[model samples]
Target chain A: MPKESDDLSTLGELGESAVLGRIFPRLPAASAQLLGPGDDAAVVAAADGRFVVTTDLMVHGPDFRLAWSLPHDLGWKAAASNLSDVAAMGAVPTALVVAIAAPADSPISLLEGIADGFRDACGALAPGCGIVGGDLSVSDTLTIAVTAFGDLAGRPPVLRSGARPGDVVAVSGALGEAAAGLRVLFAEALDANGAPDAVLASLVRDRTTAQLTPSPPIADGPLAASAGATSMVDLSDGLAIDASRVARASGVRIDFDRGALGADPDLALGGGEDHSLLATFPPGARLPGGFRPIGTVVAPADDEGNVSVILLDGKPYTVSGWDPYTGWKDSGVAGGSAG
Target chain B: MPKESDDLSTLGELGESAVLGRIFPRLPAASAQLLGPGDDAAVVAAADGRFVVTTDLMVHGPDFRLAWSLPHDLGWKAAASNLSDVAAMGAVPTALVVAIAAPADSPISLLEGIADGFRDACGALAPGCGIVGGDLSVSDTLTIAVTAFGDLAGRPPVLRSGARPGDVVAVSGALGEAAAGLRVLFAEALDANGAPDAVLASLVRDRTTAQLTPSPPIADGPLAASAGATSMVDLSDGLAIDASRVARASGVRIDFDRGALGADPDLALGGGEDHSLLATFPPGARLPGGFRPIGTVVAPADDEGNVSVILLDGKPYTVSGWDPYTGWKDSGVAGGSAG
Candidate 1:
């Protein structure tokens, strides 16, 4: 929660080894780690005989703005994004490895904040997770790439292509919060160096900042899988885009009821980066406790038919949402997308 | 092998999705991938229930120079660096996840070459290894961060603290070649476009390029471990620096023979990025086939003694090698170091 300060020691002044010296001690001790950070690599005991792995690259400006978010939040968001993917696979996160590239003139406090974010996310969301190893190098822009490894605990992984006709589409947590928060954060960026109204500031604190640094529904993934969920995905992209991805993969149409998703149709249907679990389960299967049904899976429409892979209240719903390519063009920075 | 050309399409023109489309099909199908790329994450079978993980961050300017290297070589070097670390742990690399940050205006062919490098590396070094997943973003500079996962096959991981007094030190492959190569490449950087003499070009091609794109002895790690090697590390930092690390960790001193290291004492003892495996074996132990003895581990120095961790020709050697911090202050660029 610490804000940026003007006077701080740059990474150049301290050096890579010394910066590492600052980062090493703050990491949590992971029981699954047989050998933690240091040495050439780290060893993690993967008792389930399988490892779920994912990585994300976040760059400054387009993917994030240092002026808008704290380094700790960046770290937390990085962890949350990757960990949610692991959780989406019905796995328990066990270890994380970070490779950070930053300018030598970058502050060591920025890195410490990133470390704090990693510790915070792992501590609050996945206590079993540990930051096992990392590499740091000098870059012109700040970039952090995180690879998270998870254990499946003997259960088969839940994939995106398992949805079938008659399967129910459900979500384990809130859907549009991240998208709303991002819009709020960007709006505040316009008032840079000034104060926002109380209402806007409160919304940023309660909604936007939370998404900028997310806490995904990691536990619901395994719970849903164990409850006989067929296919699953975390909503990093808008619901429409990601859901269509699942629909295309499974070759099924997912019909959504407008009333079921409640108000804020755009957020629920087109928003992205919520990190909420969306799964398809066989009809009448004992649904997981936390998941709420939002739609139903149906067979792909006939070639001659005009039915879409996604529908809103039984009608083809074609709506636009945040796209990395198109979205970044207007931001005045390179419109590159982040994971 | 292609040089930068004006006709090449840039990444911004192609967009992220299109770039990914081109990169995906080039990857060889890996059998160990229970679930391959294109999902939330990749599922890699770790039958032994243990994973040896290592990550490295490579920046364009300091860690590498685009002016000197081809894009394919950069990709190859990134994979070789991380895979070598897995091999250093006495494990077989199974999967890799890369997070690449580049300027949007960067040519798509550069990325294609990088993908080819990753592919070529896995094909040549670790037959079954596959790039399971990755994330791409735009940055002011091009950066590639690779994280590789490996299988230990139920063996105790080789650590750096196991070497004891009286142990013989050995290396699995060539040493000092990389440092010499760097010198050659750096020499070439001075000329810009003027082609070097035949001799320098050949040296740059055979020696420098070889270092830029290394082929570490991956299988030799397990062989050494099985042959009772006590301590091991990849000679990424010159022989002296890495050897000193092992010496301090094992509470012993390493004595090197200038004669055994081949020509160029400076390159052999003080060069960095060789990536060859340097290990210690107990006295009278049957050394693995590929390894050759270079030194011996001796008792730690007494408090009144002035023995250094590394010795040359029976005398304490204190000549300096690359120290990232002190090394880069004058580079004008970030002047950062790599591990």
Candidate 2:
């Protein structure tokens, strides 16, 4: 009899179906998981009578690179991306379903590594939130699609539209590390065959770690909700971009004090993939620990309903954060420092 | 202002964020879609106070190839795989969230074609169902990941563990078309420059069509549930293999009558990817239209507790079905009269 490893090549060798067989057996049985991995779909008991759902897809080049990131890191990133959406809504993630597409030649170990990453991330983010179900198919590239479900605990879901003028702006969790980490990875890859400075290398590695696995402050989302947060959004597409969304929805302008932003300006404004909660609170509201005041909201400009960022000196900053259409260039200094 | 066509490039050129921006505006608004696209997560209403969920991934090479399949077909297959799972649970598909990963150099039109495929498939299979949200990223290859949600409509979910001895076996749709289609696609790709026979060529074309865009018969799943199916599953991995699963779960033997299993033997027992519902009903129970009787359940044999396949003429046919570890050739031709 062939050993299991011999019987099953890496996910790439056995293809999608074989990989699924390996994964299905290891999952925990849940009452909510009326149907598990094998069938067309898995049925879960949607407690609170409603389910909060979100999805994110991670691709190889733009989202990750097998050469630079481990399978586990990919898994962690995939789970965090979806779970953060649940957190942004002030809901507790309960379950997740993943859809992974990889080349037929991908190794089984890599698939397992990705699964392990998912398990580790889930364990850290939401205990018991295991992968209830997913589908695997061969594709030209490696892609992960994840959908996360959460329970609101019957509380009204927090949305981006709830902010009002005079609401205090706040954020939870660090920003800019992931973006900075990505920069380092690219630079390192470009200068292959030569070693960089030890300290610089470590700094780059730390940033990449942030890029690969983001820890969304789930607790802070619920904390803000309980404290009567007026509006909430996750800092995924940079603080300025996401905050602009909140401002547009709430019909307000958000003014930022560069001094109040964390030690990193880039981390606060243009940094992305942070998965932090950027929220608003009414004046004099007592914020939970880790929740720090960053800015204030005011009426939107008469010509535009969208949010505009104002500096402490009351001038609009020329930088518009990260825009996918317009590429990001190193602006002389790292963004984490005060402007 | 460049024309959309001139401006468009492969998904890779636009990058992850740009692709997202292009696709996000095309989606329709649904009350159930609390948050649509562009966030860490999307919020959907699971109105039945419960949510039925399932996911599937489509990869390149193994699941699909760019040479024979269009981007639209890939999209269709991705959505179909997940929606079929929802149908297997006797649930009505309501919404879908997709995550896509493709090479950075992939054309935006191809991505749009993939989205169009989702839109078209959803429109045809479940009209009210919508592609509520998604994420796009770049990878070394093209991969599609989809998660589908369904409503139970107050009916108890049909599971795979409810089959009993003396239960009748039935299926609701055509089988073997997808496997047949795959064979054609490979054969054509292998002989890309050669001219094949007209009839064979047409069949191959049809087969590729079937494989590229599987039309999962979702309605039958719910019909079986309403008609009191004792046990049920989708024919994703061939009948003999899937039947064995039901037998093991229900502690019974599933004896398939070759005569009653449609007109094609290859389709009846060995073909996979049909996405047809195979269900068990009480003996002499009324079955929904299109559900043809194919087998019967019997008491388990020996102490192994494994489901055994009893063939016509008192012969015991060892289970032969599609297994990734061992390719599908033997299973595809086993227990069948070669034309």
Candidate 3:
């Protein structure tokens, strides 16, 4: 465990070279990375004549709050957001490169904490995964830009537009926990008192910890693909929006049985930032391990002529989560206000 | 031309999806990209068993300025910076992914201009190299995070630690132009007038244009490797500092002859952001195309025992450029001011 000692040492005080030296050794070595950091660029093992690539940016104010999230949590969240996209593509996560810009006076401990989180998350979440290379710069607001690369291993990528009518929509992990956690965190933050009482904190479920340290089922992506999943997406945004995306792409309607989600059905529909995989499998197809059926894809209804892309319990789902553009500046972070 | 008629259509006014729609069509398509943007992740072709990967972040205020640099220039410069590293690794540039976050009030035209610049740069400098996928978010500052991937063909990667005693040191492209350009840009920015006279602008050579839009000799890295080049590095910093890094890695010294270089020898040695390739080849080895001898690698000196990794005119060279640790705020951009 990195000592949570709040040292005042700043990255500027420790030169760029020295700061790199401090974090490089902490990174785990991966067999998939042919050449690691310190080179002009890193060399990662590829497969199937093609590779899957994706990138995401996490800014300090909009994506996260430094007050509630530790440097370690921020690092884990950044990796989780990007890695989940790779998993959503039905590929096995292989390598990641991060470019971070931070205020000059920021603590060196922030970087050290982030590095620890990066190593630990990869080790626990996707065992052979590792960060290959990265760049560090100086800026007023903290920003982390991560690009994750994955190997398809001879499988065709499961795209959002592949779902057909009668396909069963399933999920590889629990949903709405992140949004719940965000709500709780924000409520406590607004209280002006420190974190809530220990009793209340203990009541928060472990799965809800996704808001801080998401552990998406990355391996399940390839499993789902091999099992013949027709389409897929990462539930980074709320279910209503993400499912609507697939509905629009595939020209269908996603009907979700909210009551079947157990309690707090709105969490499954309106909550966001869970980073779980939402996929559709053909009827009678072998279901992948770690996946549970949540909904179904059907032909659009023509009764009203203007059909809704997503529905809840057979009716149009009116609520939505996290629309960055429509939301005001003072609104909540990336996932927006939770259900 | 991207219709420079900026109507000031803010990103907020256009909405997120609309902004993406505007830029997506403007991006050039590439054969190397098996699955392009609009997907959860992009699939890039990498014939070799391994691929080279790297990332960089360009932040506004410190890395760039809205007052001087247009959005198109920012996009081109971001692409150039990361792609140059790919070339420095002796690999053919293949694909790029960019994640940009900006203030809500920023104009949609900025993104369009950036996309145009990205397409033009890849088309001109490296055909088949184009952005494959990306993410966007809202933030107070404008930031562009670029991650580039490349194929190494069948050649081995040339590392900085491979230089041996008596190796012939050479440069694949011009040096010092970027630093000179930065100096000129800063001087012009400080002028009471927006820009200087046409004569003064012409006096700023084409090489200085590199500071804003660097065009490094990326193809030279692999050529040098195939030609039996022993060691190599990218001169994103000054030649002297970059040479020092090579010498430190190889445990040797590099001697630069001032007389061999034309007038303004300091530009060749002390200027930074050139993005040129500095490499050492075996003595009497056939030099590759686009390379010219600049210095020689030699044994570590033991007479006085005071070591300098890089030497000029057979004497220890002392001048340096862009030491982030030593500089204060209000210095040049591009990792300029830090500790």
- Top-scoring candidate (DockQ): 1
lDDT of each: 0.79, 0.70, 0.79
Q: Decide which is better by DockQ, 1 or 2.
A: 1
Task: Give the winner by TM-score: 2 or 3.
Answer: 3
- Over B1-339, each residue of candidate 1 has an lDDT whose tens digit, in order, gives 534334478778877778888788776556578988888999888888888999998887668767667788888898888888898888888888888878778888888889888888888888899888888887777889899888888888888999999999999877877777776755664454553344444445865765678888878888887888899999887788888888888888898878898987756887778789999999998888589999899888886365577887777877455534335533221111212
**What DockQ number belongs to candidate 2?**
0.48
Candidate 2 residue-wise lDDT, A1-339, digit = tens: 012233446554564455777766644344456556665567776777667788777765545667666777888888887778887887778888877766556767667778778887877877767777876655555777788887777777888888888888898887666777766765764434533344444445555677777888776777787888888888887777788778767777788877776686655687778888898999999987478888888776777633244443355543455433223233211242234
List, residue by residue over B1-339, the lDDT tens digit for candidate 2: 012234557554565566777766655344466666644456677766677888766665445657666667777777777778788788888888877766556678777777777777877776677777776654555667778888888888888888888898888776777777765654654444543334444455654666768887877777888999988887777777777777777777787777876577546677777777889999999998578888788777776744244443234556665543334223233244322
Q: Positional deviation of A197 in candidate 3, in angstroms? A: 14
Number of clashing residue pairs in every model? 2, 38, 0
TM-score of each: 0.91, 0.86, 0.92
Task: Evaluate candidate 3 and give its CAPRI docking class based on DockQ.
Answer: medium
User: What range of 10 consecutive residues in model 2 chain A has the weakest lDDT sum?
Assistant: A325-334
Worst 10 residues of 2 chain B by lDDT: B330-339
lDDT of 3: 0.79
Where is model 1 more than 4 Å wrong at Cα?
Answer: A2-7, A191-203, A304-307, A319-326, A330-339, B1-7, B191-203, B304-307, B319-326, B329-339
Alpha-carbon interface RMSD for all candidates, in angstroms: 1.6, 3.4, 1.7
